[model samples]
Target: MAGQAEIPADVVALCDYERHAAERMPAPLRAYVDGAGADGLTAQANLAAWQAIRLQGRVLADLRGADTGLRLLGLDLPHPLILAPVAFHGLAHAEAEHATALGAAATGSLMVVSTQSGLPLEDIAARAQGPLWFQLYMQPERGDTLSLVRRAEAAGCRALVVSVDAPVNGLRNMEQRAGFRLPEGIRAVNLDGMRPPQIRSEPGRAATFLGLMDAAPRWEDIAWLKSQTRLPLLLKGIMSAHDAERAVAVGVDGVIVSNHGGRALDTLPATAEALPVVARQVAGRIPVLCDGGIRRGTDALKALALGASAVLVGRPQIHALAVGGAAGVAHMLTILRAELEVAMALTGRRDLAGIDETVLWGS
Candidate 1:
């Protein structure tokens, strides 16, 4: 873990960490962390969509008793910014998720540990000072999935975020061009003997649609998942209003409006474009969280005005971790929280509840 003194003097904002990380990381690992689906169209759109939204600022508003605190999934979080789950933290820093857990705790931000994390889930849980949630990828067998869930439950994970978007890996061309591969001793520790062997395609048959997707999760699988865990269940990668409505109908605790950071599929609409529609479809039946292209505090406020309950910061966490380990992550989150407060004060809002569509230019 890095100390405060180790953080660079120029690292004053979240965006700055990206440049520093690119310089610090190996070329192959950097490409893997930054790559998205084919053509990189959707990933580029995510940032542009958020930047295009205009904020409406106000003057002479009361600022007393204002705070960023909010209650999410029965946890009273100090702020709405969450550390979005990213895999293979060891590729960026030596301490891996253990360092990230400490950084999140220091800033009072919730940390979602990925199913593909480099370290053991129990070890990460022990290092976290605040609440932790587990992001799960459904295994080929029901029993294998249940075992992961059981481990998460025993580790005291407060919620379960099931990623339902990608049935198979996307065509990440940038990663392929860079020849990215995980070095030895940095595999998904929890999935040592559990992940199913690759499915070989028959001659003259489709591989993805016919072979591997046979294990893809269906609606019935989600319903079965809900029955197996007492933790709050949130479905990630819900991009359509129809899917959001169906998630509510299936008795999910929440729905995350995301396009998997534009990593899972190419040419999909950005999360900023999908968030308002999904939030309206759910109609407050459950919390609607979103992740993708959130780099600034203003971006988070825009998401809330458009109807997101909270926003998740994804790639920036890794960038910060690479630059300064735990201290870098904490500083980056702290800077974002301060910016959120400034935006709220300038817009005449006292707290998170006071922020609504009115804060946006054309609400």
Candidate 2:
């Protein structure tokens, strides 16, 4: 709170956002947001992912009633922004997932509540004023996984965003360096009593990642999982066309081309670079959503022009929530929507459908 005198409480850009957040959080939590992740290359790459493409400006177009609204997977949004799932919200604010649910609803945006959410899924759902999706992290036990999915379904979640990227949390150097760990009181409340999976390690040898993944769900689990629920299933963390093809072949309703925001496997290509190719593979058979290093309306527009049905924004919203809770999150979306509108008008794009590769300079 020492810097509160200098940094403004409200943020319209990154500088103020970072300043206020630093004023409030302990050093370890800041590192959780800004550091770690495979020498930080993939995370750093995400920041610059949209730099290469430039939008083409058109002279004039019929701009009457210009809008940024979009429809995806049976949900209508006032704009193309979707809130990506980020966990451990209690670290940022006491309201945790409950505040985020309210914030998403306030902005008419959708939020994918994480399995690691600080509040119970039901509590968060009670606060949501708009559509909600639940992100799943396939519990070690199939029964536990099914139980959470059933809860989300009963709570009115529109979809299940199954995150496949992080079979385990990334090897976060900064988290280790800062000695960061979840506070004792804060935990994944939805999974309060579930059994963690068992792993067999060799004598004096650490259990390997491949070993843990082996204990985890595999590609073949899709069919059985689908049979257990009626909600639309979206496989997140997909980056390759081959995986997209496989997902479609097996009846996936959607795929998000994400590199886990560079928090999962390091050295993966930025979501910006991977999205176009993955979108091409889906060929509109299923909606393609993407997220990574997105900060402004221009970033979202660049992604849409590259063939994403919509874009996901995670880190920035968290920053806003850290600064001012639900209202702050709404303001961030408001600024983004305004920016998107200006970008659309300047580029002579009338609507979401009008965005295409042609808008990009080298496409």
Candidate 3:
């Protein structure tokens, strides 16, 4: 609420939240949140790519009764945006994922719980009032992955999102330079007590965590994963039209066009650039959601027009939680919702359905 008036008048206030968060968080945490692959070209491009798409406004339409609600994969969302899966929220705040889940659900938005979440999935689920989706990072073995899926199902998660882009961890030079690592006593709760795949690195090294990730999930593995969970399966980190088509063919419930927030690959195309092509490839057979570089309501509007059922916010919400806990996250979502509503009204698009390619001009 501190910057409410400014959000409608200027987009810079939305970004201010990130700056405030950086000041509030410790150096290591800030580094992890701000860092991207290699030179951060893809990270910078993610934000720039969205800015390049201009909106074409329609005038003189009756916008008296505008609505932002959308039905994504059978769930009715008040807006076409959801909180992206970010691991170890506890690193940001003491309340961690619970605070975020509560804030998102309170705003009628969805929350995607990461496999590496600091809090237990059930605890986060217990606080949610809106839809909850579990993000899966398949363990080194099939049994471990299946077990995690079953636990998520028991925790009342409505859908399963399998992140497939991180086959191998990306090079994060910032974390290394800052000498940052997951703090002691913050082990991923779901993975607690399990002997995670060992990182074959020098002892007491930052890269040790990378080896713990089993980044290999082949097409057959996807099939096996599908058979393991009854909940609808969504494939995240999809950037290619070919992979989008493959996801549809493999019977994925939906596909999220993402570049892993440019955290996985240094030179990958921004999510915005990849969305339209993937949307075309899917051709409405399935929903195509996108995430990465969505900082403002207009950025989200651009994504919707280009071909996304909904957009997901990663760093923005995390920064919010880091700065002001539940209140900050709530305020951030509230600001974004208000901006989206105003943008829709001003553009003469009264509803989510009214947003389409007609409103966007690509550079």
Indicate which candidate wins on TM-score.
Answer: 1
Which residue runs does candidate 1 get wrong by more than 4 Å? 1-5, 195-198, 203-206
Ranking by lDDT: 1, 3, 2
| Model 2: lDDT of residue 156 | 97
Give the residue spans of candidate 2 off by over 4 A.
1-10, 209-211
Tell me which residue pairs clash in candidate 1.
none
Between candidates 1 and 3, which one is better according to lDDT?
1
Q: Give the distance in Å from residue 117's predicted Cα in candidate 3 to where it truly belongs.
A: 0.6
Instruction: Show pairs that collide, candidate 2.
Output: none
Model 2 CA lDDT for position 84 = 92
RMSD of each: 1.4, 2.8, 3.8
lDDT of 2 by residue, 1-363 (tens): 122123254677644666788778899998887664768888878878877668888777898888888888888888989889998888887777777777778888889999989888998887677899999989878889999999999999999999988787788888889988888899888889998767776778655553676667778787678778889999999999999998898888999989888887788888899999999999999999999988878888999998888889888777877887877677777788888888889888989999998888765
Give the Cα error of residue 36 in candidate 3, in Å: 0.7
Cα deviation at 27, candidate 1, in Å, is: 1.5
Per-residue C-alpha lDDT of model 3 across residues 1-363, encoded as one tens digit per residue: 232112222324569788777777889888898898888889999999998878877789898778999887778778887899999998887888988887787788899999989988888887777789999988877788888899889988889999998877788888889988889989789987655665676766775355654436788788888877779899999898889989998888999998998888899998889999999999999888999999889888888888898999999988888777776777789888888887787777889998888776542
Tens-digit lDDT string for candidate 1 (220-322):
9999999999999999999998899889999999999988888889999999999999988998899999999999999999999888889999999999999
Q: Candidates' lDDT values, in order? A: 0.91, 0.83, 0.84
